[model samples]
Target chain A: MKVRRSERLVDMTQYLLEHPHTLIPLPFFAKRYNSAKSSISEDLGIIKRTFSLRNRGILETIPGAAGGVRFIPEISETQARVIVNELCERLSEKNRLLPGGYVYLSDLLGEPELLRKVGQIIAAKYKDQKIDAVMTVATKGVPIAQAVSYQLNVPFVIVRRDSKITEGSTVSVNYVSGSSQRIEKMELSKRSLKKGSRVLVVDDFMKGGGTVNGMKGLIEEFEAELVGITVFAESNFSGCRVIDEYHSLLCVEEVDVQTKTISVIPGTYFNK
Target chain B: MKVRRSERLVDMTQYLLEHPHTLIPLPFFAKRYNSAKSSISEDLGIIKRTFSLRNRGILETIPGAAGGVRFIPEISETQARVIVNELCERLSEKNRLLPGGYVYLSDLLGEPELLRKVGQIIAAKYKDQKIDAVMTVATKGVPIAQAVSYQLNVPFVIVRRDSKITEGSTVSVNYVSGSSQRIEKMELSKRSLKKGSRVLVVDDFMKGGGTVNGMKGLIEEFEAELVGITVFAESNFSGCRVIDEYHSLLCVEEVDVQTKTISVIPGTYFNK
Candidate 1:
């Protein structure tokens, strides 16, 4: 396990990136790398400065017997805006407009790199808030929630439209479906979230915000507090939204089915 | 943003980590960091050495007009075994056993740190293959697939038990449920995957391997090739497996519902 300082720096950087928001005692790294405490501290200092200059994240160093270093993944507003604008351009493509005004977003969401950027942007927005877990509905929302949760370094809970035997006992709630305008039931395992936990809700796309609202109700049933709501894209043509407070990366103003035209703009993320 | 060599190294490391399996021309980094090509090359050398020593991944330097550096995320066999062993210990907890022999694994799969490790291990297994996308079932498998796809820098497609309007046209396939011994239908959006793709199938848990087989059939329907199959854990008690070729991180040897006991061991990953 003996390694040089240069090698140590590389390993430490990877380690810190993987364990964001978790405090790592200097002694642990020192022991792991078979290095002196002073050397470990120097390596961390280099990492912290690099992370800060690039706005990659914050590396806080604590000075105490029980203290260590922590990596907080964050994205600068300028960088986030640039990313959102690019996303807006991609989303405005006429081919994205599908039947019934639904947009073809699976391609964008499926790309890991895009998801990572989106996750970083959303996670940076809520970095200052205390979040216990991330919540999202099944299928489409899973990747979005997973990305945000990865950046926040918290467990994500998946709420499903149907109950599965493997989930054991689940708490189900009925809410009005946004597009369908029909009562729909969503369920979450009782063990997924603990009582009094603070949860952040994320999704791939939002139209009437009914699905997000349903997740909000599920949070209450779990006796948890909603920290915030974020979505990759929201549709302005949905008329009225059930929820008012939320953050979005892109906003779709119009989708003309006959003309095969679509208009997209940076979402609330830039407004702030 | 003019940065020092130390700062450049940190940023370069982060960039390479985020963009794995993709070549970045040295000039790009030189321009981005406002540094000379020679300086960037030296920085990449340091990163390459560090990554190799730590077995973090491969930092390949491709020489030519179009070549630069490519980061291939990898984990050594020794490291993979240790991680799988630790996972086996966690999976052996008696409390994880749920009703009808189901295991409560939502927590482990939800943790970003753990998922990153699992993803690295599984991705390392298929690093040499031509994998265009990672495929998985909806709900539990999304995170695992996302993690692996993140490492491979590829998109992931989810096969869902139920179809949503947002997914547009989908292709459906029927398979026998391993646990319930009942036939079930799974669907994937027709546009989610492209024909002639080499897809790596992944799942959170496998019992009879029915779902994985169904995914295999679905892959054939799309005219895509199956690179391999990997799962987080498989139950040893499952009488017979439908699929014989696969890799698993951990194996649940015994889950005594009456006695409230569970036994887990390292899976085929170590055997290979």
Candidate 2:
């Protein structure tokens, strides 16, 4: 359809935001908007500059016959720190402390805005990596994985604690639960991942790192590579983590059950 | 940040996209951009007109001392039909037919772009309603709920088939599994939702409507009102649906296991 330059700019901005990490040829926009290639190029130039100045994302322009523009969603370090600190403060509230020294994160994780910000922060860290898919355990981890996957523009695979008929054939792995130190099984659908795929593992909480390790084992069973591991929060109280080399947005320094208090700090992201 | 009008427009577009169905005062944008309220108003005018003309969403201008702009994400009927038609084509693939007459929808649901479209279509239907939260059964329905919640800018609660310690103090309810016709229990955390909320129930698939009905019951137990029910797809072959007054994007006309074929058509959305 025919469109004005101002309208084209707005449409292009929306289009780029929706299709992050995917290359869009200028001709595609030129044809869609019934505009000239030169005009579309100018529109993208404005979008690219605005995205960078606002720290919204990156718009990379390629110069070649087979080249196009790509949008890479990113969050600045200042913005990331602000978001994490706010979360830490919220988490430190006495009401967030649950039994067995657990901090209630369901309410925070349930919010789409918070999830999106968390996803952007996590995805920004791995933007340079070739992540084929995101992996996380079911229930609590689904939203985290979904958010990160959305930013990275990749599908997320969920590892379930129990087998379901709906999932068809699944590959199961056994590992010790981080907090309880009890043996647990995790399963993933056989068709969820292709062999030799690179996956980034994420979770809502990491205590002993046992669940993350279990997910690592599942990735191996699928013949996939574990690019990296990250979690929304890592407990300072858990004994001896089972895995190393990971990233976390927030660290639970203390959860005082008697006093009904919790202490949180910015995680490894800020330590760097 | 002392941004130019062009930069302000781009940043504003990105902000509106992220914070849909929410209001932002003019002074807030003016202060952020280091610009005058009049300039911010002009920028919003450009954005509002572009959004409506391109069918991106609705930019409502609330005027008064406490008034500002609210972005309500919307999908035009024509665009919604096109999106649903594309999904129908994808769902009709023979390979999607799984054991026991199930159509594999993980791939489609896993796609962020497709999920965004589906979410917009579903959210558009309930945009006028007082939806406090989006509710769905765990596992398959998480992504659908997440997408819809993203559009509505609200939190989503997941109902689990099996209990977990992570979700403390859950409210469990027994309902017959639609496909198996066997009694089963689903649980939702007591703290997941607030009482007297208006919830919109969503799922990836529906057959006999037993699961949706169960969720409706769960909503009542929480003292929340059921605003509406929506599914990605519903089975036409199911015997006697348990609930009425629901919306679906697609209908599964046939899932022939012996022939390994599946036929899908536009659902209630198109019927209207």
Candidate 3:
């Protein structure tokens, strides 16, 4: 009942992916496979090399004093596409999803592992863009901002729906959200980002894409370029100019929170 | 004038520390310092070795395309103690910090760099504890939780002030915060923690240490053992029940937030 090395690598990657910010000792894997520590190390090396070649992750070894190895999730292009498409498909069920034409993303946002991977995929896409910072509106956007900030090594800045005096001076902007019904206001701190800098925007979900456009206006106020935009889930059918360059993990068509039926489709960047 | 290599190394470490997840190209550093790329590489090597020896961080280099270097904040034991003492001193201003006898932590928590360092130190202390997870109560504690989780590579479980049906099911506990006169209820997910596992508890501020005690009770409910306890700031004058194992960066004395007068004392760990 021994697993092959390839099987082990895939299993290990999946396990580590599920357990972000965790280290698994070599002995643990060795015991699981009934193999020597040295053999496990060799297998890990192969996996590490594969990940490195694909620019997807890091396999870190802590030496001595009860040290082990950790895998930090950094996905490759192919992996990102695969994950996005998989999510899109799950979200594309029309009969289940399309209710009043608004996509319900509350469930996906609550999922820890999915959120973590979605963040990694977005960050990797903009890694080389010399982004000065990552920005998103408060509450729902905070998690996505956190993920992108972690991967990009840039500071995560929060834009507030309502301005607070404690944040010091601020710049404000207005844009219409969902279905282009009406414009909404959003504001950000003036000192949060530098002028002529590149900024990456991320959000948990987009309906009207209005908030995304408002964020863009706020960035423009600071003379910063909106280098990239990403959302965990977007409704492509919304027909809004919320994002210029964006990637979505899941695209929703119809969501009925009442009936609990939702339809999902593979995102545009899926499996690319 | 040209900067010395040591200054560059220190600055490099600080810059890398501030940006935990981003990679810096060799050219970026070389351009900043007006040095050759090869020279910059040599400087990075020296810093990397020093970082490893000091147990301050992990400096990783990525090869080609989307490659550069990243500093993962992993402090050494001595560094951990030093940080705890610093926090203790900062919180020591007894007369100035007292706004109804509550030490003002608004300034400390809001500083990005300080919050980041505090998180790294806490994570460093339990670097090998096999922390099935990091735990903290909500609101002010979220930042600390985020920091520790980033360093430890574990998902931080947030104990909420109140439970929502949206959270599924929860286990509730009663504990008195230092600032509050009455005992308040806190909750955690019924499925959040595993049974008989080891957990590290962290909080932003500790006075009566009642919240920590409450957390201990919650852990017991899951049959988990308390591995350790850590606080960013500790008030020695509070005369609270001392945790079996704890660390603080700064000590606060009677603080007067209105008068803006505060007393600070470095902790013993600083000299370690």
Candidate 4:
């Protein structure tokens, strides 16, 4: 059915937001709205300007035949800072400090709004890079990876602690567990990644970066290229990490369980 | 910042799509767009009409001092049928059959677009219900749960196969694994839910419905109410299932490993 300019603007914005980082030919929208290419172009212009003014994202237009508009989701540095600072505050809560020096993160990671914010910040860092997939270890990192995948319009694969029969063939890698300093095994399905794929690795927390190193190993095993590594938070308490370069949204400066006091600061991501 | 009506419609539509199931008072949009209440109302009317005409969702308006509008996402029956049919064809692939009568579903679940559609379908079913949270067992169910949670604009709590130290205190339940017929333990963080909270249980697959029942046990332990149960797929080869009432998008009738044949049909969700 044909739609007027107002209806087109509303529906077009909704569709673009849902499908970030993907190219949609103008004719596709033109046909769907039963409008001419010229009118569709005008509607996209409004959406693009509004998106930019609001810091919602970038609307990239490709010219000529087989070209269209793409929504590249982004977050302004100011908004990103606010979100990270708020997360630091939440992380510093005394009761969140659990035994074994690990703070409770289930609640924070479960919130869709928070996850999306964190995802936007982290995704913005690699928005310009060509990332074929988002990789994360199973359980906690699943939510974060899923959020980023949605923003990047990419599929995410989970690397599990233990292999499930349903995953078919698997690739296993062993690395020292940062906290325990003991060798641990992590596995990803052989079918999850194609060789030479560019992968971005993300996780909920980082200590000595052992888990990130472990995932790096799996990426190597699969013959895939590691585009980058980032974590939601990393502990500053660790003196040395296996992987030196990475991005973190929050840095845990201290977690004094005995004193029941925790300190968190914005991550090195800002410093970079 | 002040904006014109065209820009406001574009931005307003983006905001409403991002924050589904949340009530945003007219004054909020009015203030955000720096427009008069009357103008905002007119803009919302246009958005509401476009939303309905596109079958995108329902833009519900409430009139009162504390009233606002809520976006309840919806997927039309026609689109839902098309998506489910495509899923059936994909699941019936000969290579998808694995040993132990299991099918490889990780690839399908990892997809953001397909998962969003599935999420919309499941979320549409319970959009009107009072659901405090959506619950699923890790690790495959995480993506599906997150997608649905996005649609419903609610938090999702994951039930883990094994409790992690980071989860703090957890409540564990032992259920007989449908495929293995052995008792398996699943756990949920004690803080993930509040007592008497209304919960919806979702999973990626079901055979004898052991996992769903296990989640129900956790919900019972937490003193929460079970609003509903649903799955992405269910195997029907088994003559009996512990669960009789549930919704499934796809049903697997047979997975003949020897002959390398697989059969999938649309699930009971459509019939109901």
Tally clashes: model 2. 0
Off by over 4 Å in 1: A1-3, A34-39, A237-239, B1-3, B178-181
Per-residue lDDT value at A267 in model 2: 89
TM-score (second chain) of model 3:
0.67
In candidate 4, what are the lDDT values of residues A201-261, reduced to their tens digit? 9999999888899999999999999999889999985566788889999999988979998
- Model 4 chain B — which ten-residue stretch has the worst lDDT? B236-245
Model 4, retained fraction of real contacts? 0.89
What is the overall TM-score of model 3 with all chains considered together?
A: 0.56
**TM-scores for every predicted model:** 0.95, 0.97, 0.56, 0.98
Model 2 local distance difference test score: 0.89
Candidate 1 vs. true structure, TM-score:
0.95
lDDT for each candidate structure = 0.89, 0.89, 0.66, 0.91
Candidate DockQ values, in order, are 0.74, 0.71, 0.03, 0.90
Candidate 4 wrongly placed segments (more than 4 Å)? none
Candidate 2 stretches with Cα past 4 Å from truth are: none
The count of residue-pair clashes in candidate 4 stands at 0
The residue-by-residue lDDT of candidate 2 on B1-272, one tens digit each, is 57787777778888899999898998999899999999999989999999888788899999999999999999899999889989889999987777778788876777787888899999999888889999999888999999999999999999988887777788999998776799999999998889999999999989888899999989989999999999999989457778889999999998778888888999887565
Residue B226's lDDT in candidate 2: 94
- Which number leads on DockQ? 4
Give TM-score values for chain A, per-prediction: 0.97, 0.97, 0.67, 0.98
Model 1 chain A poorest 10 in a row by lDDT? A1-10
Which scores higher on DockQ, 3 or 4? 4
Instruction: Return whichever of 1 and 4 wins on lDDT.
Output: 4
